[model samples]
Target chain A: MSEAGVSTLEIRDLRVAVEGKEILSGVDLTVPKGEVHALMGPNGAGKTSLGYAVMGHPKYQVTGGDIIWAGQSVLGKPPEERSRLGLFLSLQYPTAIPGVTTTNFLRAALKGQGKELPAREFLKLIRSEVAALKMDQSFMSRYINDNFSGGEKKRMEIVQMAILKPEMAILDETDSGLDVDALRTVADGVNRVRGDGMGILIITHYQRILDYITPDRVHVMAAGRIIASGGSEVVAQIEESGYDPMLRQAGIEAEAAASAAV
Target chain B: MSELISLRPMTRDDAPLAELPGGDPDFLHKLRTAAAAAYRESPWPSSSRDEDWRRTPQIDKLDPASFAAPGSSATELPEYLARVLEGPLAAIGASHTVVTDQAGNVPTAGGSPRGLAVPLEEGLRQDPERWSALLGTIAHPGLRKFVALNTARLTGGALVRVKRGQTAESPVRLVHGVDQRSAAFPRTAVLVEEGASLTLVEEWVSPEGDDSLLAPVVEVQLERGAHLTHVVHQRCGSRTVVQSTVRVKLARDAHYDLRWALLGGAWQKTYFDVEMLGEGSESRASGLCIGRSQQHFDVQTLQDHIAGGAISDLLYRVAVAERSRSIFAGLIRVEEGAQKTNAYVQNRNLLLSPQAKADSNPTLEILANDVRCTHGSTAGRIDDDQLFYCESRGVNREQARRLVVEGFFADVVDAFPQGAVREAARSWVLEALDELALSGALAAGYGSA
Candidate 1:
């Protein structure tokens, strides 16, 4: 793959497997600095698995390719190490850590990133973020994702993303369970953190979020591979024709190439 | 009161008894009789190959022969308990009361309207029949050997009683202060009449120079429609040894809330046994313990659901540092025919140092199929993610860890009764954290990246 522009993340022929089953076979993606890319796919298309594999989740094994972040191979690094390297993942279902308050959890994450802000500064940052997200001030004292509503939890993920200020972020299905108002609010939070130095890969099954935060590039993933890649029109096509036409095109192209090789 | 009985002389064999003053006629007689009986009947718990005592060799380490009763005139009690009693008394429009010098002395000042606090020996002499009857009714003879020993040889303790339908707006603080170089057995019996509400704070402390052993027993009974909040703060000196047992019974529609703070003591073992004996009774028991240096603390709890439709929830958390060790063993038992009972027991521990160890065993035995009962025990080091999350925000490793540990124990601490008692516990926990930081137990830049 050619390294053009400020490519913060480069996924080359990335293949991942879970429980002896291959997913994301030979998938290639790149998120250059100051750019937003949306990976849109149908249900069970391994869009979430790609985010997990890139973030170095232990369960998602990279069976074939390499994930390069900031010109360095990050395949062997653990999640915390990758986080230190300025990588963040907005999980669709954030794990609830009982007895850990949201403020305390965010503070730890910030400290781990080697940006240990002073208490006053940290509280200021969190208060501003919470207000920007329209979260109740009392939410700071609540346990991390414990007994939180779906929208509240999603907003918390955005709050974490903003506070951590990661160089690259992989948001996996962040818009799945949100209402229109909540979706807009979350998108606004995401947009506030978007800029020239940050790259965001928004993985979604619906095109609602794309309307709020437009993507420069959209890729359609099917059957563990990126079958089609194009500009923002690809999302509109997927929204219109659904995955059947693209599945047919991918199958035809694979069969033709196989027969020609034979 | 009976005449004081003097022992033969102060010998190494009779050292334990010599710790108590040779005065107080009634207390002396009770001590000699109980000590003689304990020496003759109950042999020292065998440390040889006994399964329960094998790892914790009870007899090998303790020289029971040399253990003695504590003295009468020792240093003043810790200021925390003092402030607790003084603040509430003034809040509820009570006059300044004279603080007692010894645990047995009753404070002589403005009279408390709702409850009565009397020394155990005084209560026994003033009304032996009533005191003996109440003691016999509550103290079971077979199960707890320590309670039996305490009952037989008990000296000075508090007898707090709340009259029927009377609700004391202020909490009654019972400060049991032990003297230097003495072993004190303080027995407290609390009785709440029907429709009465009372809050009792039992603060156990040893004098500064005291290396005494405090073996106290507290028995509480709540009548129908009664409400009681019991807070036990065990803040003895580092050289002090304390083994306390609290047994509570709740009647119909009675509620009991207990918050224990185990912040001090060289070796402390507390057994909290609660029984929901009447239908619709509720009990909440939560505690926070901090063990450092060579301290070893163990808390054994049992929530027995003997009646139907009773609810009980318990949460206990401990933070261990240095060579300290903590063990929490909790059991939730729902008896047969006790239907619709809800009970949950959870214990979480944070191990700050590699050498610091924590053992938790939470068990549930449900005989009634309709009952909902669950118990869980978790022991883990501080989460790397949590630590990193704190550090990345500019909190040094120490402060970040302190916050995580504070959060870990906040679940229990927050449940403490709202007042000075809660504040005292909170400050004590923070002090322990500061000590942990000063000792360099928290490593620098420890969170992974």
Candidate 2:
């Protein structure tokens, strides 16, 4: 965190590798508090790796460059500690924890961020958030996404993001595999929680979610680094064309080794 | 019992005249004498030689003489034993405990209306005939060396008998614990008469202390149409080696449900032998064992279908972390004339650390036609993907693992018939996980944010 404790994530030429193959190569991006940016990219553009890399997933190595949070380098910080620093990652696929209820997990997650609420108050807040996301109350007691359907898992991820209320949340394909109804509900929940000193980076290949919770800025990722950056207009352009224009314009140098998957 | 009273450190010669523990019964005394002779001639069980002990923790030595028992008094009892029994899981309303004072010759705890729970010595004194018929009748000695040892040297014992047509609303809890560094043998005999039903929880524990050996034996008899819900929880000290035997018999239309939860102990050997002797009888057994550090666990189970149309299902789960190890070998034996018998056995082991090891063998022996029998087993470690998912939520890596491990055991905990027992198991598993985290055994699981 910065000396003044301001919320700002500055990624300067960050290079990340997973199992000897680099995913994010010399990438630069900046997310100031209270701003939502869209990271538009295709399936193999290393978008999820960037999100995990930002969250400090151990499997992802920051072989080069630096990820500055506020003013401190958070390259070596563990996920939970970095979470306490107000960073969050909403995974594309939220896993099932057989015996751990969503309510208990959310409570523990919030506590890790140093936010302890009375039981009654916490219950009230969770209930309100669950209702706001159009989720059934029973989901609170069910195992963490154990048997949740595709759409339900996406909504659950958003619900967690709402409860944790981190300063910055990296949404990794929260829009994929979601129906129109689910997309609307997830976008509604994200919009409700965002714009309150919380910065968000929504990673997706399509402009479907952009049609709901509009992003202030859009960046196209090709190969490993950002090839194009612009305002919301980039979203319309990407929708009109696709990653093909960006992928074609930015030729692959192949500086990093390839042919491996994490 | 005279020869066993105040016997110094156990010795090979003490095998002879190792009669009934509570008191001298001519019938049991004769059987004990024969077991003594058998113990001398029985081959020393080895993991390499005996299939039942194949995966059992290697015992470099057996020194019954090196064991010690606590002095006879509540004052002399260790505080940890008291905390373990009375603290987390307070004694239930219908609870039983043998007072160690006066050589544990007294049944200090109360019992239920339909049941009579008393110390074996006190029971024998009050009704020798009844005690004689109930004790040492089902779990015969000399079947195994440890069983023979327990049958021969048991110092403290208790018996519970549920009358006919009685259904108990609350569990009859029993606390078997010790606070010394001696080989303590606890023997229990339970009889559920025809049409009687009750929930029984037997907890055996030994807190932090010097190296010790504890060998407990239990025999349960379920009469025709009887229903018994039995749960066993064992948590021994790190230096202790525990060898326990459980034998159960189910009569016509009887229902037996058994659940076990185990933790700790340097080396643990537990065997549950169940026999369905009557038609239409049914039994379900489930167990959960969590081992940390360099602890080793060897659990062997057997389901014998002696009569036709009986059903038996058994499942055991083990979670080992650090350099701990777990071994499971279970068999479902359908004897001749046991046609149409249905039996299923399964074992699942979770290895939390790379060094942690597990071996499982769920076998079936069908000697009759038209019988349905099957066995399945799986051994694995925590999914790194799941670990990463939990860590992204702000739970520290260790905390994340703690959640996943507890989740792994949640199914069994939730399956308990009683809400109180379910809650207790859940919290106890979490407490054990927290303790592991404190000891830094789960340090390797700390997930990078």
Candidate 3:
């Protein structure tokens, strides 16, 4: 009942709401094999809400939609179940679990996915990843996301994504509140994880991230629906002109269609 | 088996227990008479609608008719204890001293002080002047019926004294062996003089197939500027019942640290009462309890701040598996005019099975305006998200659960004093975990020690 592709993720007519308020309305998106799609939307445009709904966050209710992943329906699965289905969402605000170290947390997640790396090999991978992210090795010993700086927290999210290596990855505002160097390092990590088997959905309000990790297709979202779809040039246009012009154009088209129907 | 059946019922007529070297019959009589009077005047603690004893209903099952005075000598310790003492505790110059009855005996190591391991009857006979002021003062005044019973019927115990300005480099270990199928009451009293330091460990063990009752009372006194570390390990047999009470008194500028590890017992109840009676005193009390099967463990603690400028901190961790249950109740009281008193109490429990149960109550009573006091209690299971996170990394479900449980208790384990005690405790904990894993109660892939 869904489009066929080598890609594992298919979001069709996805409508999401939070507490009886529609945040994402009739949003149709597709992330095919070996491609990265950047979702650009201003504040309160339902960017993060979409990411949460796609990843099966309990709070984000999908009133009307279906998420088909890898030829299977994943709409009713829990977060952990979705994770096992090769879907991952890097949270904008990671939760701090005291008494649980990052190393242990990742090891559990990996084990849940039916993969067990030896302790030494696991440590080696973590060390290399930490080095690539320009993070200290001691961070692995600390509690997960406990008392971490903003940039360090972002790097931790990327590190988790790299280690988990899900088939479809959604980064929720990963570039927000990061300095230039930090942002660049995060983008590099994301780039390293990108490949033919992986499809990334980078959600952000700013276009600065596009400069580091260019997307094959840029989708502009306004008031919950995808208003425009274009190449990388659209990101520059939105950065220069903001959402007002495109929002006005969308409104004009809606009125014209309504008059013709009457 | 014949010896166990042929054993005569212990009574007051059984010749008075032996005295320590330089043995006073008069002082012994006086102590016995006073304790007997206290027992007669105090009523036993009953579970008939009383608030404190309601949750622990087995307290009322103790029939006074079944209790007999402790006999002289009767049971053998398990081989595992010998192996443990030789392997870890021995490395720190510590040796085990087992007391079968009132016959007070120390190991051949010859490092222990002459009067350190004296029995209660011996303390009364040999050193009445030094023991009289300490005998009943530190313990509560017939706080519970069993405590009164212990004072009334005690035959033997360990009397440890640390001289002024002296520090024992190694721990002094005492094993209180409760034998026979009847009630046995044992007592222990310790005295640490000014500027002296000592570490004392007491273990209560019951041999296999012995369905016995043990009521124990222990008192500790810390002189001005003295430091004392006390650890109590209670691991009775599954069919055994035990009731224990420990009271500690700290003088000005003295420091006291107490750790209680409850591992086994069919039904066990313990009370820890620490009284900071002098200014500038500090006390730390920590405990860990693990219960499985139908075992029940209850711990009640009180941190009474009677003097100004004294501080106390308490932390208790409990884990329950199978159908076992654990209860922890802690109260910190800062008396009026005890200004600048700082006290905190935290109790955390982990439920490993659906049938397992845990109840934690942490209370603070502050009568002073300028004091700082806080108490918190938390009961939860392993975090599902954390478990999934670990499992996703290739750690199986069981191993993931084990890691999470270990992490839960790591905060308390890290607080243990360094060296042999800490190592021994860690090894024992790992052994318990391994047993669970092997029994398939825990998941596979979690390696054992």
User: Which candidate wins on TM-score?
Assistant: 2
- Candidate 2 TM-score versus the reference: 0.91
Cα lDDT of model 3 by residue, A1-262, tens digit: 4557545677888888777767777888888757899988666667777887877665578999788887877887756677777788877766666667888787777777766699999999888898899999999999877899878988998998888788888888999989999999999999888853578989998888889998999988767778888899998898889877787888734233222110
Which DockQ values do the candidates obtain, in the order shown?
0.18, 0.59, 0.23
Across residues A132-230, which tens digit of lDDT does each residue of candidate 1 receive? 888999999999888999889899889988888888999988998999998999999888888646899999988999999999899888767788888
Better of 2 and 3 by DockQ: 2
User: Candidate 2 - CAPRI tier?
Assistant: medium
Candidate 2: clashing pairs of residues: A78-B449, A79-B448, A79-B449, B67-B182, B67-B183, B68-B181, B68-B182, B68-B183, B397-B447
Cα lDDT tens digits for candidate 2, A103-202: 8888877776778689999999899888988999999999999999978898888888888888899998998898898889899888887858689999
C-alpha root-mean-square deviation, candidate 3: 6.3
Candidate 2's C-alpha runs over 4 A off are A1-6, A252-262, B1-10, B19-22, B57-60, B68-85, B95-115, B125-134, B178-181, B337-341, B368-374, B417-419, B446-449
Model 1 lDDT at residue B168: 73
TM-score of each prediction = 0.75, 0.91, 0.81
Candidate 3 lDDT score at position A164:
78
- Error in Å for residue B18 of model 2: 3.9
Error of 1 at B72 (Å): 3.9
**What is the DockQ score of candidate 1, to 2 decimals?**
0.18
The residue-by-residue lDDT of candidate 3 on B1-449, one tens digit each, is 21232244433322122223233245544554555556656555566767677678887766644645444443343353444345555555553243433223323334333545554555555677787788777774456666666665565677777889998777777766565465656778889999999888777766556577777889999999999988777767787788889999999999999887788778888889889999999998888887778889888899999998999999998888778888888999999899999899999998877777898888988888899899999887776555544543345567766777777776666566678777766665666677667765565221210
